[model samples]
Target: MANGTGVAGASAATASEGAFLEVAGLGVTFGGLTALSGFGLNLEQGRLLGIIGPNGAGKTTLFNLLTGLVRPTTGSVVLEGRDITGAKPHVLADAGVARTFQNIRNIRGLSVIDNVKVALGLHESPSLLSTIFFTPAYRSGQFRTEQKARTLLQLLNLDDVRNLPGDGLPYGAQRRLEIACALALEPKLLLLDEPAAGMNPTETIELMELIKRVHREFGLTIMLIEHNVHFIMNTCERIQVLNYGQLIADGEPSYIRKHPAVIEAYLGAGAHDA
Candidate 1:
């Protein structure tokens, strides 16, 4: 339990202790159905963690709860030791949390660079009065925002297609474009939901490296939900397996790959021996 595996019962007093992100006793119920239960985690800064599970295991549900799309019925979420249990999505974005979706959400008609610019505009827009007159300060801010957006585009290797429509890119590039938009937010904690869901082996490998490079360059704390077991095993430092919305195993990739509970949930009884 050194990795805080069964810490769903962790006391509130210790919830904020030395963790960049912490969740204790987190759960959600939709009507009479429990989507997640007693899920807890403590993620240190600059760490990469993966969440894996069979279908309907509540992996995406957890991301929604963390990103303010869904309010939890129980527990608290602490980031940098501040409680943010039920904050709104925009509030969470301002507090340094950003996420990509399972489906590509690029704006259809916007150019690739403009897609990222939209996120930058959220925080970098000049005053309304300055905007009306196109003041020097407004012009300066616009220049800075465009520069930053281009940097993000280059980071994701989409600069070559900067002028193309967001929805016109190939499937893999579209996924990366979504990531570029998320990066424009300058987030501290980045949640990636199935970044490799629709890729061939080659594309998945490329995305895996891209994610690692981003993590290294930005010093970001990343938590991803991925179904590609090979990608998760290689990219993440730690893995948490969920079964029926509950944590069945939490540890290094090697341990999680061989855990009994994980084997049973993912492959059925005795499948590990087969």
Candidate 2:
């Protein structure tokens, strides 16, 4: 369902590089309409990539395809050289993919730390007999899990609010907590969908610092979809632009800002008019 023009060329060029994460000829169609077509990119390990476009540019649709929320009509998603196209969300999580949504998703009544611990629990496999008998192995494993959760909270700057209910934290902190929970999965690739949707200028600035710190400290590869152009430009090493479900441009921050298609997508052809 792709336009069958530049997108094929883009996909070939991307696949030739053989990066850590490769998406080739990815497409999705609904009835007769295409939500995303020939969407492709190759991401190197441990780098930050940003995706930007106007609303309905299919940014979120791409995320859904990557995370298995939606199945693509065409193309393959390969991570670390393994084809994982159409894998279920949980299966992808087990294979080292973790994501935060555009909307905040927190366990309302759970403590900030408990929320993280809940996710961390997915990694442990203590025996039911051990749990029923209160065996040292189970108890020690639980303690270790809690300790790991606290460490993750500390890493994300949420340790001070560990005991507070997740919903009680400030909005910015809630976003960070979501990242912390995602990290509990020990993912190699992290997808953040509008992580700074409702922050003040100061908070946005802080978030920029936090994202860099997390990337540095954990050596994690991150992909984020954001409407905040300044935030994305300042934080991401590489940027990809989408419009009408096609990649208009992909390059370093400087190149993306100067790209004609990207500029046109954000501002109409007559944008320079008085």
Candidate 3:
């Protein structure tokens, strides 16, 4: 559904107009092999976008590039009009970017609430002197942080297990916990990489609803990478298809579903009716 001329013209317009998250001519290579090439995107604020491709389509690589886990070989990443290319992960976090991994990465021994608290602490920690002296200010801050963590837990439906160890939670709840922790950062842009990777059908459906709720309640711009075509087609307002590090389609679900290249590359020939 995406033609080179249209995409290029859109990229040019978005660059000058200042998109919320703008990427242009993004490319990455490891050694001599190209992992991603000529990637460009312009994500407006408060939109839920999905990226889908087969394995090794550079989905994770794109996330890595955006989060500053990897540097691009060419191009720029701009967030809210500020160039963030090559920014460190912590710097990106401070700049209001947050993400969850394909695999859950909760703190193994930390309480579920504590995991969220830790992320909040990064942005709202008390002064060292106050903490060392156990000052009333520090105590008050801790209480406030705990309350905030509890609210996030409740939002993710993990309040009942707030005291339980993060890694000790069931797989589905652990995934939710990871999302809660990311939300604890109060990010403006949230990137979810295969949040439903191992979820059962019911869990996947629930996760889809939760994602929609979060987007609505928090008014956050989100980008998701997933292999589940059905989930992406249902949840995302706009979708992009990639193959061998190249984008083949970009449009609404109906358009992407019917795109010849998308069907051939990832959705298969039978997906014409999808």
State which candidate has the highest TM-score. 1
Q: Candidates 1 and 3: which is better by TM-score?
A: 1
Better of 1 and 2 by TM-score: 1
Top lDDT hit: 1
TM-score of 1: 0.95
Model 2 Cα shift for residue 202 (angstroms)? 1.0
lDDT of 2 at 71: 92
True-structure lDDT of candidate 1? 0.90
Give the root-mean-square deviation of each candidate in angstroms.
1.7, 3.3, 2.6
Residues 1-274 of candidate 1 have per-residue lDDT tens digits of 2353553554633754678998988999999999998888888899999999999999999999999999999988999988899899989988999999998899998999999999887699778899999999999999999899888988889999999999999999999999998889999999999999989999999999999999999999999999989899999999988989998888999888778788899889898788
| TM-score, one value per model | 0.95, 0.91, 0.93
Badly placed stretches (over 4 Å) of model 2 are 1-18, 272-274
TM-score order, best first, reads 1, 3, 2
- What are the per-model numbers of colliding residue pairs? 0, 0, 0
Give the per-residue Cα lDDT of candidate 1 at 57. 97
Q: Report residue 108 deviation for candidate 2 (angstroms).
A: 1.9
Model 3 pairs in collision: none
